[model samples]
Target: MSDKEIVEPLIPASGSQKIDSATKRGRIQMILLLLVCAAPVIASYFTFYVIKPAGGKANIGELVSPVQPFPSNVIEENLVGKWTLLVARPASECKVGDDACVTLLHVMRQLRTAMGKERTRVQLVWLVTDDSVIDPEIAKSYDKELAGFTFIRMPRDLAKKQRLMTWLNADNEQSAIHLLDPRGDRMMRFKTGEGHLDFKKMVKDLEKLLKWNPTGKVGD
Candidate 1:
């Protein structure tokens, strides 16, 4: 019998193995992109929350825990482009019965003026929570006094109004002024009593926020 040399055949990887490797590479790339995009947001949170300046207090306005989303159904604009000062009060509060709104509006206007050249970058929004039409005289007063104010209507139902109110925290029934970052996250609020709105404190707080956050773009 003739002697035959023994030989072994080389085997190539299965198609499934090549596909799995490609999928893994794609997933890694996606994860890296997500991290890159999210780095700034994470850093901002760290700087604002975890890192603190020695001997200095945080912002004057009460910072809302776990920032709330802006109610888009009320304001169609993204509201993310400029620092927004939101005045949230029910229209019923504005009925001829309530006189506090006058002082509230005045305080809000002064707060904006205190911003100096930065005023244009700050958007003032008045969120009315009831379906009741604003009294004509009051509407005209707003037009004449509060220039460039954005008026919006909140949900009419009491329950729905409560849900929207959850966006900002307040201790009492009195009207409150809220601050929204350029990104439109409800961040802080300034509560006020009948006629005792503190314009100076609010001004100081806003100046500090502007100095820290700035406009242009996030992290710029």
Candidate 2:
């Protein structure tokens, strides 16, 4: 046998390995993007839930555990961009009077107004749960142009309507005023009192939220 040295050839990386590496990179980038988008929301929650100011009491509005994301089938574009205070009532019940339905509407309107200049950052949404004709006076009073209110009719489709009801009545308090963040998550619920509604506490909670989660634009 001749004294010849045998050398092994170096192997190149396999296609599968390259693909796995690329996929990992893509996933990492996506995760980072999500974190960036969620940072403000996370920070606000942390401030409200974890770092309580001295003598600061718990939130007046009950926090919806795990939070309910706004149903995409139900006026999603309107809800997603701004902080929303939502109330659900049938048009038949929301007449121009001092009824519970009208009271809730007033509460939502005042809550937004209390924000002052930051009022524009908030949106009042009245979800009419039925096809009953809205009172013309009520409509005139809450005109979108003047009062900055957006009225959305409940989805006609049975499935879509059910999903919305499930979210709105998560606590079985369908008449409560719900709070939705800019990202469209229903995080808080304010229930009615004995023939009254506490406007001050609600204003405090809303102010804290606006202070902590200030956004420059509608969708920001």
Candidate 3:
């Protein structure tokens, strides 16, 4: 053997470095993807949170504090398939002839119109707080308002949680009108108060959320 040709064998690569590099790349990619997916939702929230609409124009709707993230299982089991929720805070049943009943019905009509062709996806739910049984005739009449209004009788726990939500006008803006998305998520809140609510704006935003997160739940 020639002394000049003598050479030691080269050590093989450990592959550990390559694996770690690959892992780091995967994590970075995942983070980037998450940020990209969340951009629209984050932007919408910023529009509502950071931007203060100039003047006393009165945005109408109020912002809730400590933005909540609902669990998918719970929302799916109970809230999905439910679109519009009209929570009546009065301690008694809402009969058709009463002032409260009239106001609620009208509000629902406006909500339906605001949704336009997507009206079918909109649903109405009445949370009866009292022990009194809902008059069958009154419940039957609710069917006429739109194709998807439903009346659900829930206990007080439901009301208390909602009460804890952020206030839009007064501390007690009871009997809320919630616009639930197709995935049964509560994104838009409405009121029958004196000032006007921008239902069209809300509907437009919802349409965007639906498109952006087509397979995932809103606020996910």
- How many pairs in model 1 have backbone atoms within 3 A of each other, for residues 3 or more apart or on separate chains, i.e. clashes? 0
In candidate 1, what are the lDDT values of residues 128-179, reduced to their tens digit? 7667788776676665245546777876566666666765444453256877
* Predicted model with the maximum TM-score: 2
How much does candidate 2 score in TM-score? 0.81
In lDDT terms, how accurate is model 2? 0.80
Q: Which 10-residue span in candidate 2 carries the lowest summed lDDT?
A: 211-220
Question: What is the C-alpha local distance difference test score of each model?
Answer: 0.66, 0.80, 0.52
User: Clashing residue pairs in candidate 1, if any?
Assistant: none
Clashes of each: 0, 0, 1
- Where model 2 places Cα greater than 4 Å from the true spot, the runs are 1-30, 216-220
TM-score of each: 0.65, 0.81, 0.58
- What is the total number of backbone clashes in candidate 2? 0
Better of 1 and 2 by lDDT: 2
